[model samples]
Target: MKKNIYLDFAYFIILASTFGAVLVLGAVVAPVVFHTDVITVNLLIDPYNAGIIMGEIFHRFSYWIYFVAIYVIAYEAMAYKMGQRDAIGFASAFVVVCTSLLFSAIYVPKILSMQALGVEATQSDTFENIHIASEIDFKILALALIVLFIRRLLILRVPSK
Candidate 1:
C-alpha cells in the first residue's frame, strides 16, 4: 500500500510538471512571443533574429521536456513492474514520452538548424512545412499529457482491492 502511494505521488509530480511546462510553452509563452506586439520593435528590425531568439528559448525549454519524458517513461515502467495494469495510463504516458523524444531529438534540432540558416531559409517551403509539422506534434503532445494526467487521477480515485 505504501509503495502504491509513493508511486502515485511520483506519477502525479511527473504528470503535473509535464503538463504545466507544455501549457506554459504552447498556451502562454509562444503566443506572447509571436502574436503580441510585445516584441514589435525586434520583429520589425530583423525577423530572422527574432526567430533565432525564440528558437533558442524553446531549445532551452526542451531540456526540461526531455527530463519530463524520461521521468514519465521510468515511472510507467516501474508501475508496470509493480503490477499496476492500467493500460490506458501507461499507453498515454508512453505516447507523451515518445512524442517528447521525437520533438526534442528530431524536430527541434531540425528547426534550429534551419533557423541557423537565417530568414531566407526559414521562409522557404520546407521550413514552413516543418514548422507546421512541429506545431501539430506539439499540440498532440500537449493533449497526450493532459490525457495521461487525467487517467492517472482517475486511477488514484479507485479503491484498491
Candidate 2:
C-alpha cells in the first residue's frame, strides 16, 4: 500500500510537470514568440529567422519533454506490473511523446537546416509542408497532454475509510 502511494505520487508529479511544460510551450511561449510584438518586426516577417527562433525554443523545451516521457513511461510500466491496468493512458501519452520527439529531433532539425540554406529554401513547398506538419504535431501533443491530465485526475478519489 505504501508503495502504491509513492507510485501514485510519482505519477502525479510526472504528469503534472509534463502537462505544465506542454501548456506553457504551446499556450504561452509559442504564442508570445510568434504572435506578439516581442520580437522585431523584421524577425517576425522573415520566414527563415522565424523558423530558427521557434525551432530553438522547441529544441530547448524538448529536453524536458524527453525526460518527462521517460519518467512517465517508467511509472506507467511499473503501475501496469502492479495491476493498475492504466496502460491505455500511458500508451496514449507515449504516442504523444513519440510525436513530440519526432518533431523536436527530426522535423525541427530539418527546418533549421532549411533555414540555414537561405530564404529561398524557407519559401519552398517542402519547408511549408514540414512547417504545417510541425504545427499539427504540436496541437496533437497539447490535446493529448490535456486529456491524459484530466484522465488521471478523474481516476483519483478519496478513499472511504
Candidate 3:
C-alpha cells in the first residue's frame, strides 16, 4: 500500500474494529454485564442448567467480535506504516474472529439445553467466565496492536534533509 494508503488501511482496520467492538458493547456484552434477569447454578457446572445464561452470553458475542476488530484494523494501519504484512498482523485479527465464531458454535445449543434442566451455574461463576473471556479477547487485541505499532516504528525511514 502507498504511504498514505497505509494510513487509510490503518484507519480502516482500527475503525472497523472500534465500530464492531462498540456495537458489541451496545448490543450484548455491556447489557449482560448489567442484566437483571438471573439464574442459579449447581455443582460441576453442568451443561443443562448452564445453558440459558450461556445462550444470552452466546447471543452477546455478535457485539464482542469487535474486540478483535479494533486490533486487526489498527495493525492494518501499522502495516502500512512499516511497509510490511507479516503473519503476526494477520493472525492477530484471525484468532479473535475465529475464536468468537468457535465459541458461538458450541455455546448456542449448550445454552438452550439449560432451559430443560431447570438450573444453572451460580451467577458468580457465570459472570466470572464472562469477565475472563472478555478480558482475554481484548488483551489479545491490544497485544496485536502493540506488535504492529512497534514493528512500524522500527522499520520506518527517517527522511534526511
The best candidate by lDDT is 1
Q: Write the per-residue lDDT of candidate 3 for residues 30-106, one digit (tens) a residue.
A: 45444434432342434433344545654665455544445555655566466565566456446545555544444
Query: Which is the winner by TM-score between candidate 2 and candidate 3?
Result: 2
Instruction: Rank the candidate models, highest lDDT first.
Output: 1, 2, 3
Quantify how close model 1 is to the true structure by its C-alpha RMSD in Å. 2.2
Off by over 4 Å in 1: 1-4, 36-46
TM-score of candidate 3 relative to the true fold: 0.39
Task: For candidate 1, give the lDDT.
Answer: 0.80
Q: Candidates' TM-scores? A: 0.87, 0.78, 0.39
Better of 1 and 3 by lDDT: 1
Candidate 2 local lDDT, 1-161, one digit each (tens):
33467767777777677767777777777667665456565545444555677778877877877777677677767756755555557766677678768777888788888888988998999999998898788777777777766665555553323
lDDT of each: 0.80, 0.72, 0.49
lDDT tens per residue, model 1, 1-161: 34667767877887787778777877877766665456555445255666776788879978988988888888788767766669899788878988898889888899999988877889999999988888888888888988998987886687658
lDDT of 2 at 132: 87
CA-only RMSD, every prediction: 2.2, 3.2, 8.3
Candidate that would win on TM-score: 1
